[model samples]
Target: MTRREFILAGLGLLGAAAAGGVYSYVHRPKFGELPSGDRLKRMQASPHYHGDHFENLVPVPVMSEDEGGHENRFVATWKFLFGDKKGLVPAHPLPTEKTNLLALPREQDAVVWLGHSSFFVQLGGCRILIDPVFSSYASPLWFINRAFAGSNVYTAEDFPEIDVLAMSHDHWDHLDYPTVMALKSRVHHVVCPLGVGAYFEQWGFAKDSIHEEDWDTEIKLSATLSVHILPSQHFSGRFLKQNPTLWCGMAFITPKRSLYYTGDGGYGAHFKVIG
Candidate 1:
């Protein structure tokens, strides 16, 4: 073929690829359509659901300039471990006992942040864990890396008779495999958004003990405590294929008060609606 013709063909391919990427980004799924099973199936079948968009809300840190001298030293240490050339270990280290959660107060009216999206809430003589990720790093592959500092504040052994284990979504950071396995015997009930129960079932949680709810659905835990599945602006994926399950936030309500957990999300107009 002529050189001009070859170049024109290459340009045509590039244009088509760029157009496809734009189409995917502009047409990705929104959280409002997630609750219905039929709507979720339709979204899963679409090509736009798994595509990447280049939008950024928060400014990216200029590593060298913004990190100061200490960050440079830390990066140098990380390179020595996981660089392309010589390295002793992986990208990060496994967190030690220094980060683990020690003990819950016997008074039973407290909340502790377990790093990332996990939390332990003690109220009305009940312990509730929300979207616990106790691992070093949030990754499907075991060999990658882990959180640089906090590993696990509390292991499963530290928990005493969990009343409700709640999950906001199926993402690795929100729904960790190891943490779920540890809670299998101690947790009495597993609460999750629709289709998230599949993960619990796969992890050997009893079918009857799992409660799946759509958006706005409510489950009563006790005379004074209840939980409701709420909407979130996020996507779900564990592999290259995406949106096989659902994602959401949660609202915890008691006779005296209500608390909202906004999982991982971008700021949307729904915040006004929530208020």
Candidate 2:
């Protein structure tokens, strides 16, 4: 082929691939489902729910400045995506260790970080998992948001029976569909923000197994164990609507010890309130 023909053919192939990607994103099961019926009703009942979307306690826009702030998020995002990516990733594989998670005694208190936002914690005799994204990547499209080398040493099989599966939001990073499907048989209960339970339910988890609540609401897990669904300054969406589900942080409280997991957000007065 001529040089000009080769370039034109390459452009056509690129266009077709982009088009196929868009179609896949729209139809993929990994994107999860949106809130409806009772789920939407509960979400709308939340004080943070505005006309069509959930609002942060301080109204922070995603990847952009709010009304009074300058509008530079578009440029920043473009630079983030297609610009020079130096320092964006580690030059070498990160150091890692694999712990025998199932071998730990039930009474022993422990916390294990399993790449990105996933965690496994043995607290107050309960095996609690949070933001359990064990998938290799974290997006509707597999090519995006990939995990780093050696970062994910643990898998669903590594976890014992989970007493409480707490999710902060429905973002792809925090709520991975493949990981959830893999862990469905082992988890007993699910906890998440206002509208996030819809995703769990759509993924075949029993509705009774999910404990969805608004921010500042506290859930009693056992006599001595509780979780506070705290407010976070963030937003949530998949390929569809924005902020249809709420985002949050979590505070696990025991009689003698306490821990907090800030899922995703910005600095805000809600932090003071949570403290």
Candidate 3:
């Protein structure tokens, strides 16, 4: 083929690829449905929530400028796309252990780690589940960004009735769509960061079931059990626009003990503050 013809063909292919990517991204879900009207006005009133988006206590820079005094977005993204992933995933089938959550003794406090950031905690006579993502994949599409084999042993069906379902953010890895839909009937109270409850409301959860809180706010889960929403140097959003919601750490305080869960974030002075 002629050189000009080859160049034209290559350009055509690149254009098609770019168009396909844009179409997939825009059509994946409703982008602007996060929180609007009264919900957005309420979030705007929060001290942490700036007029446009939520802000962390301490100013956190996402990425530092290099010695060259410029950030190469394309090069950085390319490196991340093809970086070495050693130890990020298990090489073989990991050993699986299943504990019937309903059968566990309720008198004593216990904690079970269910892959990634998910966990089960029984404390102060309350059964709490945190950051559950039982779906096979953690991305908008199931085929991409999948969980490792054997890492997803537990499903929504395996969980017993949950007293408190706490979510730190709106990221798909922490808050899954299918799993939440499945557990909707079984979950009594939903505790999550500000603006996160909007997603639950979209999924048909009763407004009374969802309790949204800002940083450093406290909510009484029961007469003897309480939860304090602490600060974490993190941001939140499900789609392209970020920090539309607040992300936070949580402290579960019972009569006898206090347990802290550090939601996903960079290490910062907020840890000391929380301590």
Best by lDDT: 2
Q: Which 10 consecutive positions of candidate 3 have the poorest summed lDDT?
A: 24-33
Local lDDT at 212 for model 2: 89
Residue pairs with colliding backbones in model 3 are: none
- Give the per-residue lDDT of model 2 (tens digit) for 1-275: 99999999999999999999888778667777788887788788888999989998775656666578888777886876578868777888889988899899999999988878788998888889999887778887666777887887778898889999999988888888889999999999999998888888878899889998998899997898999999888889986688888999999998878989987878888788778
Pairs that collide, model 1: 100-152, 100-153, 101-153, 101-154, 136-147
What TM-score would candidate 1 get against the native? 0.63
Clashing residue pairs in candidate 2 are: none
Order the numbered candidates by lDDT, best leading.
2, 3, 1
Candidate 3 Cα misplacement greater than 4 A, ranges: 1-32, 82-87
Tens digits of per-residue lDDT, candidate 1, 132-249, equal 8778767654555455454555677777777889998777778787778877898998888766776676567898888877666798867877888766667665554345555667
Q: What would the per-residue lDDT of candidate 3 be over residues 1-275, giving only the tens digit for each residue?
A: 99999999999999999999988776543332588777778888899988789988888765566789787766765665566678777899888797888788777799999988999999988889999988888877655568898888998888878999999988878888888888888999999888888888888889998898888899997898899888888877777786889898899999988899999998988888789
In candidate 2, clashing pairs total 0
Query: TM-score order of candidates, best first?
Result: 2, 3, 1
Error of 2 at 191 (Å): 0.3
